[model samples]
Target: MSSATAPHRVSDAPSLVVSLENSPEAAAAARDVAGDFLKGLGPPPGRDASDAVVLIVSELVTNAVRHSRTRACTLSLAAGPGTVTVSVADASPRPPCERNPDVRGAGGGFGWPMVRRLAVSTSVETSSQGKTVSAVVAREGGPSV
Candidate 1:
């Protein structure tokens, strides 16, 4: 289950928020929420950008649920002038690590790499209680460099 709330928006739109307890369905739920949110943006983010946002949402939420040694996490999305920022805050201090992809087996470690390549900007903020991972992706109609 997820709960959502937005910070007060003065000149801009409110951020999209979703709270998810660690569960197998968390990733899918996040993707759906992201897709829906993108549709509300004035001009569509374009096929590639829209797809990237959903994929990023899935990868990040999945990581929080599968790796974070915590019971819940929050997924927040904010749309800026030309970019969409997706952030997942989990109750864990450890940051995400990348490992070589498992081609033949199921020791899956591909999520982090895909996320890095898709987001033009990425950040991780760690605290005593947890960490928040954020990825910023540019919209197609906006600046690419």
Candidate 2:
């Protein structure tokens, strides 16, 4: 997947804005971007929080690539005093739904539910063009449930 990370202003806190191609690889790319962005923040968001952010990024991007039916998507990450916000925008107007996890692990569904468990808050905005899913995670880390 083609990806580009825009330059961020360090003075305002670490942030990342990236465009991703609608492909399976985009999920991994999103994780990589999150890693680099978090790394650039110096002290890091703690191991647990960092991992959760990356996982959230991967799930959101994967859901967009797998279900959005769009040719491209954008991911934005911003870290504040004690929280991080991850947002993914795709070309599909439909919002995401949480399905019962597949017991066989065939990958039919699972991402959204995990996101909800990990994130402090989650929201979706839809329009004629597409939809944007945003999740906020506490940088201090907490129980996934």
Name the candidate that leads on lDDT: 2
Candidate 2 lowest-lDDT run of ten? 3-12
Between which residue pairs do clashes occur in model 2?
none
Model 2 agreement with the true structure over 14-112: per-residue lDDT tens digits: 777878887778888888878888887766788888898999999999899888888889889998888889999998999999888898988667789
Model 1 ranges off by over 4 Å: 1-14, 141-145
Segments in model 2 whose C-alpha atoms lie over 4 Å from true places: 1-13, 143-145
Error of 2 at 37 (Å): 0.6
Give per-residue CA lDDT, model 1, range 7-124, as digits (tens).
2222333367777777887887787778878998987687888899899999998999889978888888998777899999999999999898899878888988888888888899
TM-score of 2: 0.87
TM-score of 1: 0.87
Model 1: colliding residue pairs = none
Candidate 1: residue 58 lDDT (0-100):
93
Candidate 1 lDDT: 0.82
